[model samples]
Target: MPARTVPQVRRWNCPPVTRENVDWAQLATIDLARARTPEGRAEQVEIARDAMHKQGFFYVVNHGFDLAENQRMIDIASVAFEEVDDEEKARYQARIKETGTYLGYKLPQYWVIANGVRDRITHYNFPRNVHDRNHPEALRPYLPEIQEMVEFTHCTILHEVQKLLSLGLELPENTLSDMHPFDDTNHSFWRFMLYDPRSEEEERKTEGVWMKGHADHMSFTALWSQPVTALQIKDHDGQWRYVKHVENAVIINCGDFTEYLTGGYYKSAVHRVIKPPADQEGYRRLNLIYFGYTSDNVVLRPLLESPVIQRTGLTKVIEGEHPTMEKWRKTRTAVYGVSELKKAADGSEYEIVNGVKVTHHH
Candidate 1:
């Protein structure tokens, strides 16, 4: 028998779409380069504070990773999803149903998008400590690069954002970052997402929505720009606006955990993925994202220690017992896409777990 040759996978060259064709959101851009100096850090803090408070979403530039670095990660992720055989991917399938952890491969059609229609997205999640879990054979060769990116994202970029957010809250600079130590066992992960193209019939069935509008389950989500035009966020006026793609920039958004910790001072961003526009509808949408989470033992409650939270009288005690990070993360992950969603009066779907309500919008 002859040895089989594996075809090479090429990186996706996604060009930016014309601005006039898209409804872009005007998001605040934070320059991380300014955070190097004390004065600059102070100014950046105010900018970040306002951005978080107003929209809970923003763009970050000059965060150390260059275009080539970003492209490298994207290239490797493409290989993992494109070149790897399905049988190999199945070996590391995530047991979200059995264990509630998202550390492995998630096969397509595993999630319910709408009306029992399954989603056409497949992804592999790498933990903060890359070696803590196994990966597919296709990704094994690039583990070193993957680990480097993961560490840089957590230690440098994520920490810098945490510091700004903490100072905004009038707490010690390291207060928020300390809750998510790199060496700790947390639910944080670097995800490689591949949104497969769907046929027109499938799109009609899903109502053109790839993923429903919902808040993230973690504290923060950092998404590297990939020029896809499918992401949209709900604005203060309750209107959905498209998230614009910036070159070599990262999109940061607060999640449910951040909203809980800040006593609702920082709202969780409600966003969704829909079918791409006419110009880009034929291509697959690839995304590289890092989900930042607190240590497993951190309680899901307001930080009453913050004067801002205290002064605003938002310190009302939550009705249920505070669930630790592990419990909250696992429970949410286990029920997603599997639980029956109850329709709310406002035409949204919701499910209450542990006294907290999780809502999904169309």
Candidate 2:
């Protein structure tokens, strides 16, 4: 008997974004170098704090990743998807690993808690880690161009995140550089290529591929979504407001990991993507390549950085600002994940979401 051949079927084809759709000339990005200056960086730290506190999503322009590289990764993924067989595709379905890492790719996960809803998009999910290192999930070489692009993106964002964490905690730069950039021991990343709808269906059904309003799992997420109009974020009033897409922009959002780390001045906002009222043909949303943190390690601790804020003015705000870091954390934690995490003193054994044991040693 011969081995069965896996099917290779692809039904998605959309044009690379053009001027008529998105006004890219008007889009702007925060200067990376300016953000590095002491005063400017301080303002950005505050901006980060306030952005999370005010809006769940922030539009970032001028990130260092080469625009050509970004587009190249997208093209690479699109080509790869078309080239792979069905069995190869099936390898990506979500499954648990003994090493506390999820190595498989999965479609848009349809959970029961989706407010009686499910999304209409599919994706290629992969966990991230250092290459050739001893990890629960080993990251071997796949697509060179995509790997390089993602690495550059990850390093750039990680550097910025380290700065934000330090500024939030009032720690010296040297103090943080001593520790690993992001702890891969227990920390993980879920980066994937997402496919948005082509056009809205006449009758929207529950079985198609799409994105629903849900908060990410990391404290911060750096995403490069294809220029499309489907992504949306929830307002303080809980309305799903549109997030206008811009080329060369990476949308940053707060997530559960940060909600846990910040202990609450920041926010992880709820967001989604789907068919809008105007376009009935469905579109593909390409989350070209981005990264997020895992749930096992980072702690949600309220940072009291400002010497004055910590010692004197937590209860005394100039305006309607968050009273204390703890208060902010509680608020974000509520939105990110209501379930609590219990860890052992030595930072090893801990209780997971379902009260199951998840042990990892430092």
Candidate 3:
């Protein structure tokens, strides 16, 4: 049988709606269906590559995944989060803040960045190919539906994104794909997020910021079109602009891993969530995100031989050998304001922010 054609997307041009001095630029959109043929694939690569260089983020459309199915999973997650008793949730609380382990559930407002209130976000993470022993019992019953979503996104969306990136980098077609082959070893995780709307009093205390600025440790992060608009990304001008959500589109952003691989040509954009608009203030927000990491066995280093890498006059300072996905996560957990007691691989414990460890107590 002939290979099926990928879905195609027409370029969309529209300015993002903005408020409060935040410039929301219209992000370029690429259609994944354009990637099935060699000629179309080349065009997609250029589009994706340009977006990476300019903003390190873009909206992907025409990806052959059911938006309704994604919403269905989110609905199920909502029930699991709201209906589940607090006692059961406590059992599955994330160990990252304490033990530096990245698994299970993280209660709301568990991360306190700066001298502000704890973030108004609760989340759960599901790793690809979960180990038998580490699986959380709380999510066992819902695993079937949840796992389907995770695998489909990985195979259909993330996989193609990586291929385009590799092509744009002027590397062998399989350079990045080879590093992240379709298998159990790929260190990807799906995050289910619930953002509680801020009340009048609580919004005043927050001073407009809901979640603090930070960068992801993975190669890239794909966020589904969410119902509310609170996410923002820092541009090259150092200004924070709302990452406007496009209908039926998935927002993709580079992370530190991509930065290291490209020798800083591709940067990891810092982003945060701010207080919702007055109309959306009382409504809860649900977001589905996938953080795709390089395969565990792939050692991260700059692809120095690529012509783009050479022409960009990029330095090799940040291009040296870097930790694999597992090590990076552990390192991130250690310093992500989890605990002053947390230590890195070198046995040094340090907290960037003092007196503001995020705890479950509200």
- What RMSD does each model have against the real structure? 4.3, 10.8, 7.6
Better of 1 and 2 by TM-score: 1
Give the per-residue lDDT digits (tens) of candidate 2, residues 22-116.
21212223456578678877777666556655665665666676666566566555643455555765654544322333345544433321234
On TM-score, the candidate that comes out on top is 1
Scanning candidate 3 in windows of ten residues, the lowest lDDT window is 353-362
Candidate 3 residue-wise lDDT at 127: 77
Please give the CA lDDT of all the candidate structures: 0.86, 0.48, 0.70
Model 3 error, position 45 (Å): 0.7
Q: TM per model?
A: 0.95, 0.66, 0.83
Better of 2 and 3 by lDDT: 3
After the best TM-score superposition of candidate 1, give how far the Cα of residue 224 lies from its true spot, in angstroms: 0.5
Candidate 3 TM-score, C-alpha based? 0.83
Pairs in steric clash, model 1: none
Error of 2 at 145 (Å): 2.7
